[model samples]
Target: MKNFALFLVVCFLWSCNKDDQVETYTYTLGIPETMTKVEWRSQVAVQAPKPIASVGKIYAYQNYIFINEKHKGVHVIDNSDPTAPQVVSYINIPGNEDISIKNDFLYADNAIDLVVFDISNINLIHEVERLEDVFNYYSDYQMPAEVQAADYSNFDADSQVIVGWRVEERTEIVNYNESFFSDNSLATNTVGTGGSLARFQIVNDFLYTVGSFELKTFDISNLSQPNLVNTNTAGWNIETMFHADGFLYLGGSNGMFINSIANPAAPEYVSMFTHWDGCDPVVVDGDYAYLTLRGGNACGQELSTLEVIDISDKSNPTLVAQHALDSPYGLGFKGNDLFVCDGASGLKIYDKTNPLDLQLLHVFSDVQATDVIPLEDRLLMISDAALYQYNYDDQNNIVLLSTFNLN
Candidate 1:
């Protein structure tokens, strides 16, 4: 009987250690990839539209819209008929991401350089200039924290450019501190969707863009030749940018930064509205500035929230309202309505007439929305699966206008 009891105890200990034990789990891991300078700077041109890698920034001009496929190129979509939009063409710009339109010319970043395109004739769009090595803050190959990375400590940076990543998978026992989810992310945005998540914004004759931690300004007065004028240390983890009234608003992982572009070429740092760390994008309407804090497996933030700040005074932005959110991403305004794209929770329309107590008007929960650009009564939304257009003429009865497949 004593021998039998000892045998049972040994079996339990072995089972706990070998089968039922040590906390761990499986997660998709990513490794940084590098490309030869020669390959990265391959000849770029305009081609017919093909399936884009992913949606990045968005820009609207007249009846056209530009969508970004990070490190790949930009697509020109003809939304002349929103109900039946057409893919016009594709700008084959290697290592491209953000874009902004001004006076028929489109400004885009191509890795460490700024490329300008003459789109006056959409049918024959052509590249006019390639300003090299200007974007010192260019971070095109940033991978997610959720994906455990392999070491590449001795990687060469002189002749190799980090173009993308190599993703793979492996399993381990479930660890309480480890994490994994659908797609290994709520959504990475690839380039982060919508105009609200736009890295570039054109205000006046100056083009402003925010990198990971700096503000880069370009003088686009020459249209065809945009020269890099100023590169100012913006803030830590700066992600998105917006131009409202006469100021440039930069949204980062930790807070909102306001800069005076009074001297377009040289933006002067004004103030910052601090908040909990998260991936965010700031959008402004009239006297108030709106942003959403999206915490996710990739973002590393603790909570999802919506914050509204009074920006009447650019130097001292005051937070007057704070609301809880369900994994919010991008936000935009349509007159009195505020559209919040809350990941899987859906696209929520709020009546901001009462900012202190925002009234939830409606929710389009069928789609996994990422960001939005409210154009007139029509809303342009980018999600994980597609680029969606909606008609919100009837605020209470918002209807899907059309969709362009992204995946």
Candidate 2:
């Protein structure tokens, strides 16, 4: 019989390579570590508002749903028909927050500039260049104990003529010495200093910006003259940076940095995975790295966390689990699920295919989500300024296939 059809074609090619092998499910939470109450409370069946106030992410494309308002800017929802989501347009842009689009252009960012829109007129989209002062020459740091000189904890014995008039006061205070503090001093308004604008990403044609400790690299292939090319020093505050395969996974407040751009205008650090510090947000696949640490304090001490790391041995990184959510700001991943915007633990969902057993599953709560995008079937597409579409029912409940109001 032709040797039994070659043993059934080698058992159907070994059962189709064990069903396309990528199976690594490890989610646990059979509740009952003495079960610390959580009877369940997450419901927001629907909501759609976008005249803007403080939204953060949502992009569904192919019928629209672009929102990004976190201080206003971008909102265009129509979604053709993902079950009716309509708000048409509200592309304002006044102090935008975050946005991305790639192909047809749309790379917003406010609180200190970087814009580029032209949705190819998805319905009259506009603007196409903004890029302000690119940090207008950042220079304001202080913190060497804020130029100390006194506080030897009430020293006395004539404290050497009051420590020689506070060590001849002024190791340096700039900004015209801020009227000598004490108007409720924390350096009393200390203008022009420290750092901000600490995050941006879009590797591959480059855009990588970040501040509060430098790390730029523009050259958007010429998004109307981007060109900056390379300059590193991001010792931290690099908010986010994922890329993949060729690695570039940063996350900030000085922790995870992994660069190895394979030579995209020279980049090659490849190592570093500290954790728990501040404002971190990262997501990666094909070797794992899904971080989140929402700033620091603790929870009441401020900042909350949720980590899941296992960089597939990327220079030995490991700590496959840690969750204590509260302010876990934005971190999206689709496919083994892991979405967290937690500005109060609102849009959290985690399964993470066992990166050491991470499994939360669902949460929708009070609408302060921030960002989360995943649109193919079970649909999920969130953002705060207006554009939400959860839908995950069959009993797991979480309905609301659409709601688009991008004001």
The candidate maximizing TM-score is 1
Clashes of 1: 6
Candidate 1 regions off by >4 Å?
1-33, 144-158, 164-198
TM-score of 1: 0.80
Per-residue lDDT for 109 in model 2?
A: 57
- lDDT for model 2 comes to 0.57
Question: How many residue pairs clash per model?
Answer: 6, 10
- Residues 1-407, candidate 2: write the lDDT tens digits: 00010000000111112433422221111111111111110110113334666555565556676665544466676667777766666766544445666777877654345667777667667666766545421222111222322232222211111101122222232232234234321221222222234556677688776665566677788765566767777655565666788777777654788877788766677688886557676888777787777654421225577777788878877876788887777677767777788865578777777777888877878676766766665555454445667755332666877655544
**TM-score to true structure, per model:** 0.80, 0.28
Q: What is the per-residue lDDT of model 1 for residues 1-407, given as tens digits with 9 covering 90 to 100?
A: 10110000000111124443454445565555777766776757888778866767666788998888866788899999998878899888877778888989988888777888888999999888888777755433555444443324433555666666677775545433435322222223233311222388888788887777778888888889887888899887788888887788899877899998777789999999998778888898888988999876446576888888998888789999888888898899988899999999998888999676788888888898888888986999987668899998988778898988866
Cα error of candidate 1 at position 391, Å: 1.9
lDDT of 1 at 218: 85
What is each predicted model's overall lDDT from 0 to 1? 0.75, 0.57
Model 1, residue 57: displacement in angstroms?
2.9
Model 1: how far residue 293 lies from native, Å: 0.4
